[model samples]
Target: TGESDATVTNVIVASHYMNYGGYDNLKIASSTPYPAIGIKMGVCEGDSTLISILNKGMDAISQKEKSDIMNKWITVQYEHGVDMKKVSRIAIISASVVLFIFGSFYYWNRKLKKEVSRRKEAEDQLRNSFDEITEQKKIIEHKSEEVMDSIKYAKRLQEAILPPTSLIDEKIEKNFVLYLPKDIVAGDFYWMESTVCKESNNELNFIAAADCTGHGVPGAMVSVVCSNALNQAVLQHKLCEPGEILDKTTDLVVERFERSKEEVKDGMDIGMVSIEKISDTQSKIKFAGAHNNLWVISERDDIGATSNKYELESVSKSLFEIKANKQPVGKYEMRKPFVTTELLLEKGERLYLYSDGYADQFGGENGKKFKTKNFKNLILNSIDKDLNAQKEVLLTNFNDWKGSYEQLDDVCVIGIEI
Candidate 1:
């Protein structure tokens, strides 16, 4: 076979023939300068090459361009929804101003209301407190008046029960009585009566001072009962001796109350004396007491003066051992029977009788008591003074010692000079 250059040339001739026919026909039909196939074929192959080049040149682009693209995508949707810069700023400013005004007004209004409420509560509390205090004051005044009235009535009764001062004076040469009450009605009472003793062939004159169990109304009532019983014992019962008198009074008091009733322990502490004068220099004294004793003040001539000045009168200590009845004039379960004592008084001797009240009373700057020792000293110091002046001295001393404190007990003192 021959080298076939003829066959290759024939094939080329057929491709050129096809191209020319299509190209000429499209040119003629479209009336464009180039065939559509030419442009399409060139573009498809060139676009693929351009895409590969763009991917390779990515690192060469500026950062601004990359950032702009990213921001554009994020804000793209909100841009059309609102005009944020202009309209939003106006709305926010208006709302904040309205809220500030409302909050300030509300705070001031609440503060004013709280102040008004607090003032009203204070006024109400003050009014209620004043009312309570007024009511209590009225109650106290009423109670005080009642106590005073009771005391006044009891005092009158006590005065009527006591005998005249003349009766006591007739028995002793010179005498004095000092009586003080803790309240309006005293717990202590004094008595005087006349009697005759057949055994010693003597006409006896007697005086008595006594302290009842309690003070105030309770004590006053007991005093009334005791006073009545004592009179009856002397006059009606005819019990002359002090011991017999006390025994009779005790039986009467016990019998006055019922057996089934609640028992009351109310009785008296007493100092009783019978005085009779034989001459100007000689006299007789008989005494009895319940848990109490007496003292004697006498002038001694044995002591002399020094430096031409009269010596101070000596103060001697002597106890009047009155036979005390072991028993109280009441139905006490634990009481011993009373006993009587008799004594004869010489000239220039004095006898004293007193109750525990004055000694027990609280006084002094330190709130201490005007005790027995001080009382004795006072009596001795005032030996030259008259009975009335001596009494005044005692009262002054008591008041001075008492200072500003209230009297705690009733006070009583009796003195007799033979």
Candidate 2:
């Protein structure tokens, strides 16, 4: 390092730091003893306040930490080899030393000025470069916002396509749709349609909760496709059975996506239910699903239905979970026909169709998923309350379960009183 130091003529850069290291002796004369280096931090005569503040800050550090830092620089075997008298004489001739120190400081200041000038020029160039970068960043951000705006407009269109609130309220006497999108738009969608069977002239109320393969834009696109397929199956094809609609929807979605040259495998999992009122007090319900399940909650009390929510809250309720087909709506290796399960339900029973979003959400005290079993329990517990109160309780429980965690997926829960 000394050889490297000797190679350079003016070593101002090393002058600041070289003194921090312990050395045997500092020799600046022609007859030298060792390398010459020194480092000292000081304030001017009028800077008592600055020194006091610095000391106060330094006092916060532990004594051991400060000692360790000091010992690293001041070696245990350090010997300046100068007595007090000589140093006192050097102080007595303070005027001459001050002149020399001032001259050296002036020389260093000149060097510092040249450095500052060079750095100023570099900073000007860097500032220009940063300005260009900032401008480009702003442009990129604007374009991104515009893209998001377009997507938001697309979300509005998607919202329009969903089963209207009026329609659901009209078809089902008491219903609650708990729909939450992970983003501005969602892949999980709920749809309901009221139709009359051509054969028997019976009114069929069809409802479905579907979860697409993805979320956000891509999933929403697939949802749109699947929803259209459902529409075609009911309105165009006149197919009312849950199984028939599922079959037609799967076919249409697969056909549409496969139309592209790249083999696309986009699909969805759906739980569909068709309800037809057989009598004033009874109804026939057909259910089908693809990787989704259906839940039915019996009335808390069959006694005279009360208008108040708290009146029925104390009554006990039971839940029934029906498993679905293992296959998805899209292409699968072992594809089988979607089977429809037919059931008869009494008045005051509630039917629940939902995506896996709620159950699969990651949250809780231990940060675990709210699995399907627990979700069924939640539905069963809330079944005693009125439909609107049930919605409030479910959302409150979900929020409590999901403390500060993000919603993992799109959630859609549809409950209808039979």
**Per-model C-alpha lDDT, please?**
0.69, 0.82
After aligning candidate 2 to the native by TM-score, how far in Å is the CA of 154 from where it should be? 1.2
Off by over 4 Å in 1: 1-143, 164-167, 170-173, 198-202, 257-260, 299-313, 316-327
Candidate 1 has a TM-score of: 0.67
Clashing pairs in 1: 325-338, 325-339, 326-338, 364-401
User: For residues 297-333, what per-residue lDDT tens digits would candidate 1 score against the true structure?
Assistant: 5444321111111223364433333335565667777
Question: Candidate 2, overall lDDT?
Answer: 0.82
What are the per-residue Cα lDDT tens digits for candidate 2 across 141-243? 9999999998999899899889888888988888999998999999999988889977668999999999998999999998999999999989999898898
How do the predictions measure up, each by TM-score? 0.67, 0.71
Off by over 4 Å in 2: 1-107, 299-315
> Judged by lDDT against the true structure, how good is candidate 1?
0.69
* TM-score (C-alpha, index-matched) for candidate 2: 0.71
The 10-residue segment with the lowest total lDDT in model 2: 303-312
Measured with C-alpha atoms, the lDDT of residue 95 in candidate 2 is 70
